[model samples]
Target chain A: MWRGLQVREQSLLSLLLPGLRSRGPRLQCQAAIRALTGGPGPGPGGLRGELDRFGGITVRLGQLRSADSVDPATFRTWLQGKCEQWRAEGRIAVWLHVPIFQSQFISPAASLGLRFHHAESDASLMTLWLGEGPSRLPGYATHQVGVAGQCPSFAQSNNFFVLFSGLIIQTKNAWKFPGGLSEPGEDIGDTATREVLEETGITSEFQALLSIRQQHGRPDAFGKSDLYIVCRLKPLSFRVSFCPHECLRCEWMALAALATAEEATPITRRVASLLLYGHREGFDKVDLTVRELPALHRGLSYKLYHRDLPELYEKMSAMD
Target chain B: MWRGLQVREQSLLSLLLPGLRSRGPRLQCQAAIRALTGGPGPGPGGLRGELDRFGGITVRLGQLRSADSVDPATFRTWLQGKCEQWRAEGRIAVWLHVPIFQSQFISPAASLGLRFHHAESDASLMTLWLGEGPSRLPGYATHQVGVAGQCPSFAQSNNFFVLFSGLIIQTKNAWKFPGGLSEPGEDIGDTATREVLEETGITSEFQALLSIRQQHGRPDAFGKSDLYIVCRLKPLSFRVSFCPHECLRCEWMALAALATAEEATPITRRVASLLLYGHREGFDKVDLTVRELPALHRGLSYKLYHRDLPELYEKMSAMD
Candidate 1:
């Protein structure tokens, strides 16, 4: 009966339906949506139910139908009802993840008491808190967030060689560069050094910021877009002690060898290519400074091979 | 006397002093510090009193001595006293603009109920409200904020020519590219197109994301940090409508000519250079498809030459 009805009518009919009306408002809403369009909601090997439990049930409206197909008023009524149900059930919060293209839904969601939460690739997370806790959300003073990293290198046989593959323990270990999330109040330079130290046990100095791989929604991003910075670093020591939790191996493979390794992460490959051809081709470098920029709080900036330490650099300088 | 004392002592001492403590706690504290340190206090051409009147008085400790000079506790007390006074006086709000490098003060300020406000190139604006409007501040659901702009180009007589520059009114008329603050819930591409249209009145499509300049603190950033994005654009039409308030004029001069223009903003020159060199280099192009990127609610992405009409594009193709 709901299948032939328009989305607006479907929502209204679902509210009045005998079978679905008795169920939770959220269920009734979903039923109405499912009646119009069918898809596996949360099943084994589908959009995981655990994720919904952990981070609130997310409804991506654009994923269901065309912008013209659904009316904002209809969605708002359904969403508001679902939130009321959640409030009664003591669910702390609910997230309405809307496709970026469905801008018309933004106002409706806002009107439905959903506050702008965060954004991930392809979806803007507008959240509403149903349960009584602190309504205050975390605010990063600066609006911009970024991540910067370094591909540490050492001098060998008069050839400036870069590290190939660092290893991580993600499902039987894979090759990747030493990197992690930035600490609060840490700069790209500091973050690069710190992340490298923790992951690969390397003490290094930043040379030059190399390249940036910034994108908005990614599957792994906690619904927030990120800016990844790549830098070149001059390693001070060869001592290696990989953290078991973050990394299992910290082998310094040559760039050429790592380039051929099929297991290297895509970012690692891209960074390798950047190291090989970036300088000559026209990749820009950024000065590692944070105090000058207030709007950007987090970012990763990779560095370039500027120079070595004084004593070694002097000896190498004389040779060069 | 206070110069030799620790920051904690100074705060305690300021609370105790008689002549220095007669005024409100904040003023008394400052007087106590001033009595000891012998630094200038609220004088002409010091910190600019009008800014204090309009906004709140900003006490940047780094300005007084070294980055390592002031302790967080002293600054926090001084800051706390000021807020209390503001509250007592029934002042609506107050802002504490701290230097970005003075991160030690961040925790203390936060403890004193200072919230992350905004940032500029040179400082981060942390705010505390004294009035009873609402404790909750506006949160832009999108975590990142940035600007993306276009350098529209044309081909003439085998010369790959681009538009020279647009003019903006910032106190006085200045030669600048067309851009402005991102409107609430507006995408960077939309920001770029809208800013361009509003400033220069020239309609164009985004060609590519040219460069990014993100900084936390800037002198003119109103204590808020900003990210300025530069992009390449292809102009579709020559007609223009200049906005009087935002822009004084928009000109399409020779790129070579504008590059050497002595009055051109440094950023303008940098962007012009980017326009000249970006395409051949690894300067990546961004597809202006908002739907494709879920995490990104705002950024600089090029608008594909979305044809207004099939007939017009088809006719143009036939002519070519």
Candidate 2:
């Protein structure tokens, strides 16, 4: 009985939406607009999506009523019809948000050439480009990685415990660590050392990653997230030749003084105290050291940042 | 003498590339294509760009001979001509790579509406979208953040020190922590707890961030970078009701056994040892605690992951 009904609907769909019919056997006939909008599917609004800035449509499936309750076959039919309509309307992209509960719809979506762009704990985002060329749809979680170099002055004797600081041209009277955005394919350590050289003309070696700050909606980063990594550096050359465009002043200041200075940023002050602690107690307590490990793919490696394992524990684990 | 020559060149530009004249007062001419391509500008390749997948062109200024030596005025004129040519060919985007040494060209490029996309230590990449709607160009360093929840079993007594482990269906005999990728706008801790509940049907509370791994060129992530964070969790429910699709088997294994088990992945083994160390000494030694800080924008806050400062130091710094 169900087969007969499906065949009748399929014939009707072919007559009504010729675009869907030409998409091969994958296109199945589902309920029409009246059934989708007025019937028991996707709540009162149905599956209508808002137009995005890039001539794409983004449908938030999670917002639909009983989103997960829809049968997979029915959802697939509906999606095929929607695609045909969107393509005819000159839409360039389609972004579908399928909540984890409604993940059954993912297979149907993927079969239609929709690819997984990214997934969150509650849902996964899939995208399809209907444009002439490749999908110009952007990637997920666009983040800018910035590295700050905390270089303590090279101590000629045991008496000095000063730190080198740069006064940023953009910020009034605020002392900041010499740093900049990490280039594509650049390592954290390499970025820290290189930025220190460019901004302050201080050659340095990366010692350890001290802290990480993750912020979102940065105006400078086009409303994307930013990851700021602070690294301890060992100064190779102490002479200051600061870039006039980047820094107003560059000088060595006492760590204690910087820690209490009202002119320093909160992060800089917090790191200053942390550095003081490391100087007194030991660096191992505060440092997140880097180690390279083989990636799942051959000929590729990744960087893992973690607290250094104690010597005794390392030896014990080595026995395995 | 310079002013007279500049006026002549500007008149010639208006006649040759009418598109430049319509762009208003910002457009200025200095040199022609022969001077730009054949002479000292942008090497022998003559400022030519390769077509991108999205009907755009990408010109790497860093690859040019004496790239930084090009006068900004001359480069500006060359850019105007190229833009006019690209527009006529129905190009959708223009990507210009300007090295730090050649940053003088940035002003001219920005005058033409090219905005900063991303930067490396040596160069900055800028882009302009000429598509009908809006720019669909993707963001830099696309990263997917994945979280793994390490949940120890809920012990009824002091003697039991077991940990819940799941055998991933994708890998043969390899036990992994139950976790998933974080959703957009979700916190790290929230993702850990939510994933554990979804995959294992085990309720857990997020404890502390344990480790971080940054890898690049992941096939699963559309050839972008991946940041995997491991978090410690306190299990609320001990029973295992694993999703069959994601796991082959789920069981509670002794920490000592799992730490030495050959079936465990290298990272799993390493984390196990760290957990053991934390269990014996204290979590404070291995944990990177989370703190909430005010973002630069009003009504927004960001998460900072770092080591816990000593109580004495926090108190001392509080005085400041």
Best by DockQ: 2
Docking class of 2: incorrect
Stretches of candidate 1 exceeding 4 Å from the true structure: A1-144, A152-174, A181-187, A217-223, A260-263, A278-320, B1-144, B152-173, B181-191, B218-224, B276-320
Question: DockQ of each candidate's interface versus the true one?
Answer: 0.02, 0.16
What candidate 2 gets wrong by more than 4 Å, as runs, is: A1-126, A129-139, A154-173, A316-320, B1-10, B13-126, B129-141, B153-173, B318-320
Give per-residue CA lDDT, model 1, range A104-129, as digits (tens). Answer: 56566666666655343234456666
Error of 2 at B285 (Å): 1.2
C-alpha lDDT of residue A130 in model 2? 84
Docking class of 1: incorrect
Per-residue alpha-carbon lDDT of candidate 1 for residues B216-291, written as tens digits (9 for 90 to 100): 4433342234455554566666666777856656666555444445555544544554444433343332221211
Question: Quick one: best lDDT, which candidate?
Answer: 2
Mind giving the per-residue lDDT tens digits that candidate 2 earns over A1-320? 33454454456566777776556554233434335322223433266667876689787777766764666567766777666656656789888876544555665677777766654324457788987786655556456678898886534324654343422222444677888887656778998999889888889888888888877777667566777889989888877788886787877667676777777766777787788788889988889888788766778898888888888666545433
